[model samples]
Target: MKNTPLNLCTTRLHGGEYGLYVALRERADNVMNAETEPIYGHKPARYLLQEIAAGNKEYSELLLSKETVIGRRETGEILHELALLQTHLWKAGRVLRVRFLEGPEHVHRQIETIAKTWETHANITFDFIAQGQAEVRISFTRSGSWSLVGTDALTERDQNKATMNFDLSDETTSPDAFPATILHEFGHCLGCVHEHQSPAAAIQWNKPLIYSRLFQAYGWDRQKVDTNFFEQAEKALITNSGYDPLSIMHYSFPPEFTVPPTPTPHNTQLSAQDIAFISRCYPFPASSTASTLLKG
Candidate 1:
């Protein structure tokens, strides 16, 4: 029951289509299975936005066919630029409060210890509170680990509910995987996307082979495979950080996934580039007064 790393997409509506946006959001939320482990949940709204921004003719036609009017003024260029800027990083100098919704004391202690490793380098702070509303609520489940990306947690309807989950209940989650899993999910919470999806990575994926493997392994259909693996991210949507195959944000791919059999090893720790990139994204100000609280 080892949880796969899943990225949650956040949507922003423009052109006063708040009603339409809400309808879309409700549809997306309702379809997400709370117990199912999604390799990358097939998020139509997110997929539509990404595709429309990339100017994919097929998706554009699909949007039009569905009678979904992306406002005339909301050009693909504007959406692409805005999506790139907003989704790349969180606001600096923010104290993100984290609360444990459900977990044994030992597991909670371990998570608290490992999660703070990011705070040592980044400007952000993870304040673990006991009895108040928190920005990040964590819980444990048998399904694979996942988290909403960055500011998307703030948009959740249940403000006090858990926004991140760890698969501690899974007996298959080894001790070696614990730190990596926690760090990886927290990476998502910090606005980092899968390193494999980095526009600069330029991975040569063997589509038919990948589709066959994912379908057999995860019950994913053609659409899910295309959305999760085959889709190339918009180059403009990426941060300036150069690609690093060693990033903890990357999932190890087997040789078969690539045309020339490029096998990426499973990364269990943050690369040097990871620290530098996160630091740049959330730089600590010299005049900052907030204290870093490390819980053992």
Candidate 2:
């Protein structure tokens, strides 16, 4: 496989947050395997619904993009890829099991606390299991923080390995560690994408400046910059909650990276919109009667 850049730096708060980034570049000689699944084929129909619930219209369009038809031999059985706008929520009220493959026990509790903030508003529940295959396996390494989006966690071949990773090793002990970063990665686990990538967010990016800074800061090449910062999610795939500049899922860009020199703020907590959006996506069953009535 060709070398693909790692998707690091979900929250680039400062130089300290990038400690792992520097180490990873030196260790891998500035190249790492993409280690992600292919994007072709039908993802779960619920993902489409999840996008819609987040108020993205492009998701519905993406669902209508194309279909694959499979014809059978003797029995004339046929398989077809249909575009269905279904809820991508975990089995309605299922407890998503999580486990830590690495990281100190203290940090594990911290991670759990940060993750469960989503449960306060959303109907989803996370159960941290002591053993066995967990729905979300979290590990720590020099690789910058990232998590597989939503149901893609189930597609991993190495069941014992982690589907998510954070830069929470011993060397990365900064006071500002698990605030927004944990919320951002867990947002990805719940099927959220970078808020900046939303088509509605018309950020006037200073492309040359962004490219130059990232290359110098993280050893990122042109392709990596494009994929991580410039490439917009397919309108059909995005569940836009309207261009929220304060969303926990947004990255703080330096003033130099923007056209008019506007410095994007580092969001330390979930914005009110973030809470409202997740609530809509995974509302408490009892309080979701209005949503059900609307659907009906």
Question: Mind giving the per-residue lDDT tens digits that candidate 1 earns over 1-296?
Answer: 12332222211212213322332333233232242115223333455644554767453454345443344323333333333334434567778889998889988888888889899889888888886888788877654467776665655546556678887743325687778878888887887767778778888889887677766655667875665565655553345778888888777666767888766776888899899988887787754334443321
Show the colliding residue pairs in model 1: 3-144
Misplaced by over 4 Å in model 2 are 1-89, 169-173, 287-296
What lDDT does the true structure give each of the candidates? 0.63, 0.60
| Candidate 1: worst-modelled 10 consecutive residues by lDDT | 7-16
lDDT for 93 in candidate 2 is 59
Minimum summed lDDT over a 10-residue window in model 2 is located at 75-84
Tell me the spans in candidate 1 whose CA falls farther than 4 Å from its real position.
1-71, 74-85, 169-172, 287-296
How far is 253's C-alpha from truth in model 1 (Å)? 2.3
